[model samples]
Target: MLSVDNLVASYNAGPVLQGVSLSVQAGEVVALLGRNGVGKSTLLRTLVGLVPSWNGSIRIDGTPLAPIATHDIARMGMALVPQGRGIIGKLSVADNLRAAMRAAGSRPALSIDQAIAPFPALREKLPAMAGTLSGGQQQQLAIARAMVGRPKVLLLDEPSEGVQPNIVQQIGQLVRKLADESGLAILIVEQNLELALATANRCIVMAKGRIVHSGPPDEFRNEAVLRRHLAL
Candidate 1:
């Protein structure tokens, strides 16, 4: 499980995340929805230590996390699939996955085959350069790499971005399967409404760096409610 309490973060002289708070339980998928610049992505980055937290606490399974390095955070069972996929284009797909496992440092981990099982399309591309793959393939590779570490919490930023519709559905199915089978707690920042609804059990809406609404997916599906907070 992951708990973030009154998290405050800033960029330069301006604050980006103002007292944001949320939590995700094991075997649950939570979608974070909002318009652009609402600090959805910043909250993810802050939880993973990419952005410094100015105040409050982030705890993984009740352990404070702000004191550790990002790599250590990954080793402590947190994995992030960043907004852009963030794959190493020049490296072979196998190497990219290997890097994450290496950073995870011998925790009970998933084999390459197990990691790639959800993405059978990526199984054959293991020896190929990651940059040469299509956008969907690259995103699959990114998710696979994150899973190889056998993380307890998965932070996914815009998993649907730049992905084809079919591939987005594939990702959604894989995410739901992971939550159910792997007990992976997922916090996904997504703009695509349908993808969010399909992938997450619950939805949290944010505005101006603060969470404004939290409920089941059906409440989020109501057009008027969604439009009020997300302006979608």
Candidate 2:
């Protein structure tokens, strides 16, 4: 479980997240949607402690996380697969996965085979250099790396970006499986509305650093609601 209460953050330009609030429960998947510069990504960064919160609180399983170190946050049962698929290009696929398992500390490490089970393509590319893989493969590696951490809450920032349509669909299925089977609470920041709606059980739309709308995926069926909040 995760809770963000009136969360606020700012960059050099000015405040980017202002009094944003939301929550995710175990086995639940929530989609964060908005136009450019609406603080969707900043919220994820703040949750992971990559960006400091200016105000408000972030709690995991009822434990406050805002003042903790980024690594400490990860150790507390949260993992982030960032937008760019931050894989270690020089490392082999297997090595990348192994490194993440080690970083998970006391949590049970997912074996290489188990980690790549959802991503069969990664099985054959175990010895290949991560940088040598296509964007989609690299994305799979990113998610696989996070999976090895055995996180209670997974924060995904634009998992579908730069991925092909087929791969995007696979990513959605994988997310659903993770939540349904693993009971992992997930928050996905996505520009791809279709993927967001397809994967998330509920949707939250943000604007100018605050949440303006929250509802089930079916809310998108109303053209006015979709356009008013997401400008879709």
Candidate 3:
């Protein structure tokens, strides 16, 4: 569903992703794993055009995406739930979901009620201000908001970070459901190895801004592979 070839990207100081390449098939979940500051998030941002690629090509479906703006990328069926949840703090839960739907430029296949079904806590809080929610609740809101867009490929950056264990597990289950039932291709950047293994069908490990390992989830369970590419 998505393919990236020899992707390179950088900020003012220097490059953060160098010659990275990967692909996500339809209805598959791919986990992007790495220790802190290894450019996992940068690669996602570059793919969706939030950060411009210095070199390389990114294609969604069969069309090149390198020239599109980030908003255009969303219209092309990609949704990003960034690291911080990126929720509009002052907006009500319903408004947040509505905004995402509007931004995507189409009615979501999953309605707001259905999107929040997996997150029961969020359902009761739809009228509440997003800023008033706890970290876990906000994370749920973020995921729900993304679901409201009905993206073909969902890019999630550390959805488990700062969330409670129970909520994290719930999020993992939702990720699997999205891939299995809804046929959404998921690319998640996660530091939580257990969550990644449980949620994603494949794993890509990065080090020093390059992919060091790319294989099925079981291949990443090897002690040697984890130590070499992701050990802190």
Candidate 4:
């Protein structure tokens, strides 16, 4: 339900994203894969209006998104779980989630209990300070905060980064469940090729800030494609 066309973005005269184009259909999980500095995160940021699009069009369910404020894009049903798990360190877990819901302009369909059900460990840490949680717990909290918005399209940037193996699996399962059960379109920028292939039906590979390959996840599983575009 999201489409980006011929997107070009740069920072301080150096191009970061060059004419990147891609789309995500409702209920589909599209994995964005690239080596370091390929602009996968830049594309995600540009899509959500965090970065200005120098040249391109972004449409969400037919609504055009300009180079406007991030909140404005979020209000239109897109929520981003940024790479760093951008949570307020001092805020209670509950408040952090509530803030995300307010930012999305709606109360969450899933209650804190229900939302944390997917990550049972988070349920017990409701009153804890976000900064005090483990990295995995913090990542789960970040996803939980995004879920509190009940978004149509969830943009996740490197959810598994720095997370332990078990928690990464948990996050993967939750991501797949969100797409399958809730019909939430997911565009994930991930460095972990195996995790992306396991969770996503489709994969888009970027090289030097442009899309080089887009196809079924299985198709991208080839050794040659991995070595050429993704393996670092």
**Quick one: best lDDT, which candidate?**
2
Question: 198 in model 1: Cα distance from truth in Å?
Answer: 0.8
- Checking candidate 3 for backbone clashes, the offending pairs are none
Q: What is the lDDT of residue 232 in candidate 4?
A: 48
- Candidate 2 similarity to native, TM-score: 0.97
lDDT of each: 0.90, 0.91, 0.88, 0.86
Error of 3 at 41 (Å): 1.0
Count of backbone clashes, every candidate in sequence: 0, 0, 0, 0
Once fitted onto the true fold, the runs of candidate 4 whose alpha carbons sit more than 4 angstroms away are: 106-110
Q: Which stretches of candidate 1 lie over 4 Å from their true place?
A: none
Q: On lDDT, who's better, 1 or 3?
A: 1
TM-score of predicted structure 4: 0.95
The full ranking of all candidates by lDDT, starting with the best, is 2, 1, 3, 4
Which residue pairs in candidate 2 collide?
Answer: none
- Compared with the true structure, what per-residue lDDT tens digits does model 1 show for residues 72-165? 8888899999999999999999888887786565686778888888888888899999999999999999999999888999999999999999
